[model samples]
Target: MMNMITDMKFLNFFKITACLVGIGVATSACAAGSSVLKIEEEKKVPKIQTIKKRDTASVAILGDSLAVGLYIGLTHLARKNEKLKVQKYSRVNTGLVRYDRYDWSKAAKKISQTDDSNIYILMFGANDLQSIRENSKAYHFQSKGWVKHYNERIDEITNAVKKPGREVFWVGLPIVGKSNFADGYQYLNDMFRARAKLNGITYIDSWDWFANSNGKFQMSGETADGKKRLLRAKDKVHFTPAGYADLGVRVAKEMQISN
Candidate 1:
């Protein structure tokens, strides 16, 4: 009877030890599974796209039909720089000489007040070849009185658009295929260059690009790469896309260099 009681106690003790070992193994397996799940959760976390801050410049294009052409090229060029912003304010067949139709000074001042622009591009004198309305009378183009009145109008427009931190670039008129129109544009370019210098504005001379070696206007012009291409349209007043592209690239390069 004593031997049987002792053997029973030993078997009971062995059974208890096996139960403890099984519990420990299960607990260790559960802990390992939990560690694996935590690693997977970290891997499933999404990555976010972040935009970097860049240098920026605000540009305003102000003028007539020629300005519209310039704006097309300028806008294309500005997009090359992710930070460049371009605003266009162009009037078709409008100029400083024709204030009765559309006053440039008032328009410029309004636009300047509306936006904070660092660069201002001025291109005009296309429709200024016609007669100007001054003091309740019409003055013929190229006349002494007409020139004087036009100069005053130019000064008014230039001064009105200026702000504290704005830099102005006055682009000269390009040569037209018509001799009479070319003459008018040449005279206007002279006035533009002189007034721009007087008002502390940079003048961009576009005549040489459109003019041939003989200093005459040509429908086909050489690009920056010296490849001859059709740059002018049939009307001779506006530029072809290729012409604007070439000019726009050059202008953009100059703008970058200026800074």
Candidate 2:
């Protein structure tokens, strides 16, 4: 439970800080009248604080490298939105149910125990596609039994974190690669949407930004000013910095000030 919450949590900083800027004065060794243009006084950058937010709202992200927000772009988003309490737990390379992989249960336990009322954001499945199952060598999604087990484990995670005044959001996977994986991606996305609906969790569709009118992944994304630009990284599996910014802003907008 804690894993789910911590994984998606982001911090919000509302306080501003002041800094002093000094204009370059002539060094004793230089011409005394020569001076370089510089800031000559202390100034405070007004805090661009998180909007009025619920004291308890939080997010936890879980999944593979994508969920972890690798690359410079994702790191920038995290730095910019530190106040949102968005925790992330993505392994370098893995998916939802690797046989020896870490599960959300461990983290979920901590979040569930917290006294604060908050929301969770779950981002899993990248690794699950080929993850080995518990007590066996078989991978997840290979059989009905395994799928059922996978879904049940998800439920267990939710149950552990269940409480009044709390909420959840599940972000579905986007299409990736250029082959059979595309079909698999769509299937998993469909399952994710269904699971989110059944569990009464908020579902964020990566496809909305990733897909085209014909339902295939769109390599470019719409910018704030409406310009379309390539948003995915070279791998075409993840987003660029601007892409993360777009996603983060959209999320902030959807949450609607949380309070």
Candidate 3:
């Protein structure tokens, strides 16, 4: 009888121990699940904060001399708008075709890494009507090889400036007095437009803005006040102060409309 009683006691002790072990395992599982859920919740907060941080408009103007004029105009506009900021990174007589003189691709990448501006305005191709040298061979302007290489350079600049939550605006070259120059500028504009579309950026067409009613190059145009003023410089390549201011106004209007 005593032996049977001892056996019963052993069975009861085993049942108690098993119940305690089951409770401990359930508690530990719940704690581990809670920790995993907490970690997942923490991971989602930073992305939301990063998106919110990039909501302001800061303009970064880059390119050749034409871009310098546009930057002047934007600088003036920014003075009136407290929220707007404008910065320039342009060089005279520089284009993608002449890499030996000025390597715009490398310059653009460097600028993008350093500048915190969310908006980029680029205007080039004014001086690109030359030969491109690659692999010790020269590709003359308008040739298939030239076009291919020039388009790649465009892609390089576009990719360099493009970032999440950033906007890019490529200003097309305006009409020139010289027929040959105008033809080349038109071709460059076509390429710029196509690449801008493919890269999902904005292309500002300045051709019509500076052209006369007959759609030809004109030295003068009407200002915001509707006053007839000289817009083009003597060389017919660069713009006068008034011309750049008008161009700036056009770009400013675009920025406002986009917002």
Could you tell me every candidate's TM-score relative to the true structure?
0.74, 0.66, 0.76
* lDDT for each candidate structure: 0.77, 0.57, 0.81
Question: Per-residue alpha-carbon lDDT of model 3 for 117-186, expressed as tens digits?
Answer: 8788889998899999998899999999999999999989988998887878889998888877888999
TM-score of 3: 0.76
Candidate 3 runs further than 4 Å off: 1-56, 257-259
Tens digits of lDDT, candidate 1, 1-259: 9999999766544444545456444555555555555776667543221212236767788899888888888777666766778888987878888788888988988888887787778999998888887778888998988988888878787877777667677888887887778888989999998787666667788888777899887889788768889999888878898788776666655555221
Q: Judged by TM-score relative to the true structure, which candidate is superior, 1 or 3?
A: 3
- Please give the ranking of all candidate structures by TM-score, highest first, separated by commas: 3, 1, 2
Backbone clashes counted, model 2: 37
**Which should have the higher TM-score, number 2 or number 3?**
3
RMSD of each: 27.5, 23.5, 16.6
**Which wins on lDDT, candidate 1 or candidate 3?**
3
- Name the 10 consecutive residues with the lowest summed lDDT in model 2: 11-20
Q: How many angstroms is residue 197 displaced in model 2 relative to the true structure, after the best TM-score fit? A: 2.3
Model 1 TM-score (2 dp): 0.74
Tens digits of per-residue lDDT, candidate 2, 155-181, equal 666566656566665667766755656
Model 2, residue 17: displacement in angstroms?
71
